[model samples]
Target: MPDKDAGTPRVFLVRHGETEWTISGRYTGRSDIPLTPDGEHQVSSSAGVIVGPGRIIDPSKITHLFISPRTRARRTYELLFDESAQKMIEGKSETTEDIREWEYGAYEGLLTAHIRAARKERGLDKERPWNIWVDGCEEGESADEVSNRLDSIIAKIREIQGPYMHGEKGADVVLIAHGHILRAFAKRWIGFPLSTSLPMMLEPGAVGVLSYEHHKVDEPAFLLGVNMGGSR
Candidate 1:
């Protein structure tokens, strides 16, 4: 199902900037970790890219700016957008359980290297031996589980396109969320199943733009761009 001319929402998805856990390569799932100084600077610098004299972003066109309730995401929204912009999209800027990072559960707080080392000792050496997205969630969700959850969230966004794209002329929507979840969101957006999230490595502090063209019901959504680099 494609979005009707009711509106075409341009979503600028931002993975929350870095944190101490990220720098340390720890699995900070479900943990309330604050941004490191570098993290804060990364997001703050994006503010200049999106706004200001150069003003890459057309402020007047932006409407709904969404964010996870996590401090890291919320802080990014605050820094990237202004107070009034936040107010305009407060309700839409919601904390979605689906938008939350993949629940690492028992693996939380462990580094990839450490996990792999432990796994190697136990003969768990494989690309996705412990990949929660495929196997069962180790004390958490399977990849299918995470995919289904994110599907519902994307559905909600599509359902609210009218108000989300609400603007004097048009609107640009923003979502500040975690890396893994956002990657899953991308997978779902292209009509791929949950397992498709395997290859798309959503990097931290990255900003991706999703654009589409709809002339009628004839053309679905055209994949305008994705995982675009340049501005963090």
Candidate 2:
């Protein structure tokens, strides 16, 4: 909570560790699945290396954390920060529905290939592939709705970090959530449409950084190809 030197404020997007559905490639929206044993180990190993001083995420610099309401995301957050660091953020974390996985609705437990095959059988998309960005889920959220919610979250983040950006140090906001929502959040973070030509992918137990270029809040960009390290 202490203000530091002025710098470009950053938002760290962390995709939750592996779950049964994640390994099987099923749509896991709104499901309260727990992390696998390997998944737990993956995140626990990352905590010490990537979250301390002179690391990708300095624990002291994280002002706030937004976590999804799902068990997977919450468990990932717990495994990614050790006991003392968790104590420091005891009152700083908020579990939010906004940060939850993209609602899969009718397609909740279905895999992508299964959904596509079902669509073809039902005469939905027989010619081309079913793209989530374009086709979306049968009864779930649309691209526009997802974009709107993420934009609102981004605005709230700026509201908290705006004052610190111009000072000597910047604030850091961390988000612990699912794969699709995190990617969509990053896409909207840089003012890009959900159907950007360049796609972004995040592995289980991975971290991605989003910040402004040239220290200007208006110039948002992703820190591409820069390995934060200690993530699997």
Candidate 3:
């Protein structure tokens, strides 16, 4: 494939709007949750920050609008664009399993407090039996597990920037996905330990822009922008 980024594709990753579980701080895994009325509005209004009046980004300039196959992500994309505009990205939006949220497994949908109570009852203190980072699902993935899973997706983005986009220039890969995974994305991209993922929490409909102006991955990829305000 020809490189699409002769001049490094600027990447802007957008987390989807709110879900009922999200507002409650529950662990939402592969459980396809839909956005609430507020979430729909949030995505609609804030989306323009990327493409509309802010005009910081041009919708047509995007080479790819990668979206999780999860309903929330897809729904956000659909609602963010008007009928005609939706058609542009609807056809181009890529379904990426890697962009899916962290797997909550047995605890999926259980609020944090409830899970903590259950964990205490089970005698599974801070330490998870298996790798919580990987096996977070009922037999699903953990934080570290998900981060590694995203590796391929990240690599694919890099590949798009290189010889593919035009030769070592990254392209704009806008991802619309859930919260935990997005936080994990930021953590891993910076080569921080998965535990580090704990410190940063991304809310729904947040806009996070990660770019590597540096010559090498070892070099720090400036945050560019992190957790910008949302529609709400």
Candidate 4:
């Protein structure tokens, strides 16, 4: 396949692999759940395909690694890279609270059905229903709150990618975090409102790419698809 955006800086949004809560459809926020055995396998398999030279996410080309301060995300990082790649990542990685999962608060660890039922009992969603994008959790981070922090991260990334987007090499940034926040990050990356439902899905252990159109930092956009061929 031809290189569509060759030498352009990119942002890789990686969602942590499956966990107990993920299987149960629970809202895993501040809770630090470990990845299941299958989760580890999932990320490792993904690494084989994407984390190599000339692949979608070449570890040596990664300039910055912003990871969530959660156990699952941390472990996912470990599984996503081999010893050599991890060595390449040194001095470029930061474990930050800014990329942590959305603070679920009252709804933490609760399934969506249960959360809505509880809210109904409390007479909270009479007009419509509890929607995280609009209603937010009773005590959790609002959509605006999530957007604010993600904006900060995006600003930092744009600064890092500024001089490199123009055909310069080795400036890809990677973010390892949970479902909702990564989706929110993508939305905010393109200056979209969080209330605008994300039509794209970032599955566990799946990777999403964001980059500039025409190799211009001012033209940030989602890299909708890439064909990961057999090996690097």
For residue 211, model 2's alpha carbon misses the true position, in angstroms, by 0.6
Residue-wise lDDT of candidate 2 within 112-159, one digit each (tens)?
899888888888876788889877777899888899899989999988
Q: Which stretches of candidate 1 lie over 4 Å from their true place?
A: 1-7, 52-59, 87-91, 120-128, 162-171, 215-232
lDDT of 4 by residue, 94-209 (tens): 99999999899989989889998998998888988788988777788999999999999999999999998765668889999999999889989999998997677878998888
Model 4 steric clash pairs: none
State the TM-score for model 2. Answer: 0.91
| Candidate 2: regions farther than 4 A off | 1-6, 166-170, 225-232
Worst lDDT window (10 residues) for model 2? 223-232
Looking at model 2, residue 219 earns an lDDT score of 75
Better of 1 and 4 by TM-score: 4
lDDT of 2: 0.82
> What is the lDDT, from 0 to 100, of the residue 214 in candidate 3?
38
User: Candidate 2: RMSD over Cα atoms?
Assistant: 4.1
Candidate 4 structure lDDT: 0.88
Where does model 4 exceed 4 Å of error?
Answer: 1-4, 229-232
Alpha-carbon local distance difference test for all models = 0.65, 0.82, 0.66, 0.88
Q: Which candidate is the best by TM-score?
A: 4
